[model samples]
Target chain A: MEEVHGRHSSGWFDVCQHRRMSNTRSLPLLAPESDAAAGPCCPPLTERPFTAEEAETAARMFKALGDPVRLRLFSAVASHEGGEACVCDISDVGVSQPTVSHHLKKLKEAGLLTSERRGTWVYYRVEPSVLSAMGKLLTVAPAVL
Target chain B: MEEVHGRHSSGWFDVCQHRRMSNTRSLPLLAPESDAAAGPCCPPLTERPFTAEEAETAARMFKALGDPVRLRLFSAVASHEGGEACVCDISDVGVSQPTVSHHLKKLKEAGLLTSERRGTWVYYRVEPSVLSAMGKLLTVAPAVL
Candidate 1:
């Protein structure tokens, strides 16, 4: 396991170097512009009762973070340096690599994460706005002005 | 269904009046002081990776809000006119009364809410600090000062 982790870690560094040399533009799996255009998906729960559709959308995101392993993997990525992480760096959450990959896929599907495959490994990032959006969803509106 | 909702709504009003007249102190199921004493349970995920214990605790709260019905019910209580809501006022989320109670119980168990019994109704409050704590948990630290 250590050997595999080392190899992947080195592979990631190589990809970074390659990208710098070639000046290849990073292609995000989900367009950040689209997420911004979508706007805050729901008002703060303290602002008003969620519409059924809004509740469903918000619930999906929370559900994705409901498991300990998934939440750990997500935290590992979110807290990693540069607001992103290589799968190689974050697959150490006491789970098998396959399980780690599975959780990453679930997070991606739930729109909580965006990923790109640079070389042999995948890089994951929490969109800058996603966490703030979630915080806003649960925020207690400030005394209604 | 409408009739039942009306009855409950009136019951809540009655309870409110009784509390006002009798000068009864609200008895919160969980003391707000204890939550404050515990401090923020975990640093923002963006601040650092969570320990297994921290992730476990946080995941339980997220899991409790993971379901659509529970999320809706929580929103109902959270977004009600005041910081707190009577169960009677927020039980119209297209589920049976028992199911609504079940979801509310789950939320309380997760430490997301506190409740008090008054007359015929149970009043639920979002515990001002809990929402802020959750918001803080997801907040991206402000560019590390």
Candidate 2:
């Protein structure tokens, strides 16, 4: 059965999460336009609720990242060799075979990762737009004014 | 109790569940990256789990973004009028009041959001490094190459 979980792990999970968290926290303090290219447009969170469109968009991504197995798989793949990791590489990444595939599938649907087959291997790569958009969303911080 | 139940308003809940189901069948994918920066020092998830330094750093942020409430709150704040929202504005969003507070606190603790007292209103905005680093992390998709 599939259990609900969060996106980050500790130890190795720290790299991406660290990069992302520090990044997300920094922009609000530094400047405004840095993330404007990718982040959502609006004011502070405490100011109001997200609109339907915003909520849906963000929801889709979070839903994708919500799974612990998938999140770990993402970490494994990202940390894999050649910017891509084969399914063979992660068969033992602390989960069952089907679980790994299940996560890869969810991530693909989210458009955060894409795959291509090379012989017997299917490698995954991160979608820049998606990554940038995520970073952007995190950057939308308080307007000092 | 730490029950993060996503109880919907009956209709919305069903819709969410349905969407989740469809998403599962549609294409649960895994997003990976090939970073030009960071100089390729990490190992595979299967080969070795994430390091504590790595895990703690990453986990904090992922935990921040893991929840639906936090995601919505992040969006609402990011999309706010001036890029920051105050308590009054945030209180009006969906989810339970306590849930909202819980998420906001989490976000703040993760260093994504910061709060301040502006006369009568307590305002929240995105942190600086949090967004900046998030952007940088996206810019460079680290791969095993």
Query: Among these predicted structures, which one has the highest DockQ?
Result: 1
TM-score of chain A of each: 0.74, 0.62
Question: Candidate 1 — which residues are off by over 4 angstroms?
Answer: A1-32, A36-38, B1-39
Please provide, for model 2 over A1-145, each residue's C-alpha lDDT reduced to its tens digit, 9 standing for 90 to 100. Answer: 2332333233433333323212111112222243222344433333356665565666566556545566566666555544455665544546666878888988887765678786545667555455545655544334432
Model 1 lDDT per residue over A26-138, tens place: 32322446763134788888888888888898888889989999999889878776657787667778887788899999998887888988766567887656677788887
| Model 1 lDDT, residue A55, Cα | 88
Worst 10 residues of 2 chain A by lDDT: A21-30
lDDT of 2 by residue, B1-145 (tens): 3333443223433333333222112211121233221122233232333554443454456556656567777766656545566654556566678878888987887767778675555667665445544444434333323
For model 1, residues B1-145, the per-residue Cα lDDT tens digits are 2353354533446456455334234434234575532236778987888889888988888898899888888888777655567776777778899999999998888878888787666778776566677788888676542
lDDT of 1: 0.73
